[model samples]
Target: MAVYVGMLRLGRLCAASRGVLGARAALFRTWQEAKLQSVRPLSSREADRTSPLPIGGLSYIQGCTRIRLVSKTVGQCLDATAQRVPDREALVVLHENMRLTFAQLKEEVDKAASGLLSIGLCKGDRLGMWGPNSYAWVLMQLATAQAMELEYVLKKVGCKALVFPKQFKTQQYYDILKQICPELENAQPGALKSQRLPDLTTVISVDAPLPGTLLLDEVVAAGSTQQHLDRLRYTQQFLSCHDPINILFTSGTTGSPKGATLSHYNIVNNSNMIGERLRLHLKTAEELRVILPSPLYHCLGSVGGTMTCILHGATLILSSPIFNGKKALEAISRERGSMLYGTPTMYVDILNQPDFSSYDISSMCGGVIAGSPAPPELIRAIINKMNMKELVVAYGTTENSPVTFMNFPDDTVEQKSESVGRILPHTEAQILNMEAGTLVALNTPGELCIRGYCVMLGYWGEPQKTKEVVGQEKWYRTGDIAMMDEQGFCKIVGRFKDMIIRGGENIYPAELEDFFHTHPQVQEVQVVGVKDSRMGEEICACIRLKNGEKTTAEEIKAFCKGKIAHFKIPRYIVFVTDYPLTISGKVQKFKLREQMEQHLNL
Candidate 1:
């Protein structure tokens, strides 16, 4: 997930049967008993039980469920889970051969938190965590705040401290820090005085001690004293659920990336709901092990992977510091992992591995495929080949605590492949006509808007930008063209800005991209609008072919002809090896458009 290219020793902690198959068999019986004794039945007001709106009715719905929200901070949630399942396996970094139980993980987090406090990092102070997914990364993610984009994010949020590894792959973090803050070379540990980054006062190295920086072990040791322990306890008293815990920067495809601030309340409830939907709450730690190859820095890993596992008391397995398809498969087979999280591209890479068939991935039952629009073909392939029958498609942005819609385990294959599933509980959604500024009819494409507890507080220090999308009524305009069907399933069509208007006819590129995915020769495709002198814009399809397959623009065009509307057919087709992608794996369509425009001289 962090783009490193190295092999790590495989961990064999949970490689054996471990009675997982027996525990899985007991899962349903346990769930039934739990439901009968403690769980409440679904209310009539719940979204899934309600009747569909009329065909011409407004595309608006609310997920009114009986599930109460978790009124606790992130730290509090972790603490409660550790108390309940102290001996359960909490985290396993297979590549690093590191494993920690729930109690041990909490101990590590508290030590890191105390260490941060010792270094002048207060509860509200910003601390940027920069590195790949590892044991240290997990500690920092739960112990304090996180950030990305080295210089921009540090300055934007006024980071008070930074936790980073000594070196990741080819990038030496200390060297980069020195280049950014030249005074770091001469400053005393925990007493940095810099001109470029004035707010930075401390730097903690995860690997080893460096000049002018404190070693992670040294800081951890410093926190073991009675004085530090008392201070940490006192500091925890002032923590609030509404306090911002994470500041994730947007992809910045259209503009400079803005930090979308998320509160503890937002992510805690979101993660719990996601886990409940996935039925993870029904399984014990031994019965459910999650293999996450996505970067911990991203929301998919932090909120979806890490927090969800914490809430459900499931085992979290890290296959590698960076994403390696082979390594991920090996982890799944060796650990007997039950769930796997990744983007559509990551899944493609995994399935394309030459020895993919050799791995025993049958242990996997469910996970999430998100971060971009997954073609239906890919979904079917994953279900058939990967043995992930309950695999769900999730849709959301970083601003919404990253998950708004997800498929239920019992949902039909068509629903899973075609739609992003129903709205999450406690969330309200409506499709609005961009021009009319009113709710659109069911099954009609429009800009999707969501209002919920999951909505972010606002962009960090950008009120005007926040107001531009989030209205006074609290509806966060998604800027995504989507349609809600009669059954309340939502299908994202395309980005509003990416929609092409050719001679007054609207064309959504996602539809064409989905169509092209059905082609036998195509592995992936991105359709973008190209500037045209006559019709204002024309369609350009950039496609990546399957391995060992060859095709031409004429053949691709021929495939599209007669299957779709004439105007929907691409005017220009170009074969591509890959599309420009963000670190989180979302295709940068703006960049793709720019490249095509330059190549065509348009």
Candidate 2:
């Protein structure tokens, strides 16, 4: 999990540990006045009813649950919930000192959607949102799109409007926007005509307006007119559940980012299913408060955090502008937040706080631990120290609306710690032999593939690229090496792609190697991930310098300063004469990683 103070981005369990489940019933009773509708202890067979195997005993599992899928658009779902719980608190941003009821949040979202339309943003127009987690981020996320990787994403998607904060930390977003579209200096507000970004016409500043940019307040006010309101109403009528609603960037091995296009149907149902697993549907609006510290740009925040709350009428408390351990702890105590959403690393940060014991996090009954697998020790700490007994693990890629598997609240401690839980309701998962392209037997590791409503439509405008991962039958090849037992519990063993997940951010080694190849003194570069105590995995770059040329690690770090995300920069840089090679001359990255681990004593 990345934490940013200003404007810049910075970068579980054994069977014996199952003792905590002994008091599971008591824990639920404390959280809810009445008995929970579905908190009963479940045997392993009762918890996950994996379908019987076929004649071949293939590694396949289809989720079987009484709950049916919700077939409505995201906007429609929010509208229905607002009507049911208009007086209930829908959002609370503590740092911003902002709180909104369900009715008020719906009003704000509709007004913002109108504002976007008033500025010539029509249906299907791509709009990019850039900033820290805030009320504004949530508003724009529901109104339109949310993204990062400014220049590359803007150019790739041909965004019609870009909404960003004035500045974050030391990075001046206005200045960065100016660099991308210098015409902003001379053009009128909402009339940007840039030679570099021809498709981008409107620039929106969340803070004070800059030259040729419209202030967010101005956009919101513009929609107050009757004429704009009528247009907004007309536009909503044309919205469809299958229409693409979000474009999240995920790095590929091809050294460029692929925009995973998600539709309203994809996310709305996915979030609903997730809420069902957490038993959020059983709690009232007053009883469920979710403390979310994850950044809104990722799926964990947008789909898992925001949409789930909307679907279940749960109050969402923005812990802080960014991920701050102290602030998160304070929010739970002050707001009586019932659930906390974060990665294992985030849990570590909170648990390590010197005054952690002083805070009253007992209100936190459960949340999600995602991004990467959690160690058994960390799972124990979260349950024992933080009072997150119902916490569960989630697994998915951006392409699948971000969540395909999640543990039920009543699952055994061993299942929660060892696997990513059973397949979500209405989804199908199967493991295939990497080389044979055939289904694998149970308990055998293979490439995991998913087929269901959760999968993305395709990579935005990249048909060929989309075909590489998504098959004709709509099974998205996750490229994750996983094994599924007869009970349908899945364990991720490794990745087919060399994507280093530092914190929660995914960094592609090929992308970094491509960037390093541009360095003057670098002849070849190989990037790999090494074990990291806090970050799960840290990047280590092994470079072969050009003949008779030399460069220091500091020099390489300096070169990467503004060129890529700060998290992608290698934590360890090694100069090598040549990489370990096989008899056939292929570079052996495993051997290279072993050598680095020995060198760093990690």
lDDT of each: 0.71, 0.67
C-alpha lDDT (0 to 100) for residue 260 of candidate 1:
76
Question: Which candidate leads the pack in TM-score?
Answer: 1
TM-score, prediction 2: 0.76
Clashing pairs in 1: 1-322, 1-323
TM-score of each: 0.91, 0.76
Per-residue CA lDDT of model 2 for 1-602, tens digit only, reads: 11110000000000000001010100110100000100111111222333333235678887766566655566667667777778999889898898888777776655565566567765445556666777767665631222324676677677667667788678687887787678898989888898888877887777786889988788777766778767655655545566565666652222345677776677777887788778776665555899988766666776788777877788989888668899999999999988888876577678778798899876778889886556555666687788888989999887998899888777778888778887888789999998899999988878999999889878777999899999899999998888888777888765676667789986667557757866867756778899999999999999877668988999999999999988889999999877664211224566777888998999
Cα lDDT of model 1 by residue, 133-167, tens digit: 77766655531122335777677777666667788
Candidate 2 weakest lDDT stretch, 10 residues: 7-16
Model 2 off-target regions past 4 Å?
1-56, 143-148, 251-255, 498-602
Clashes of 1: 2
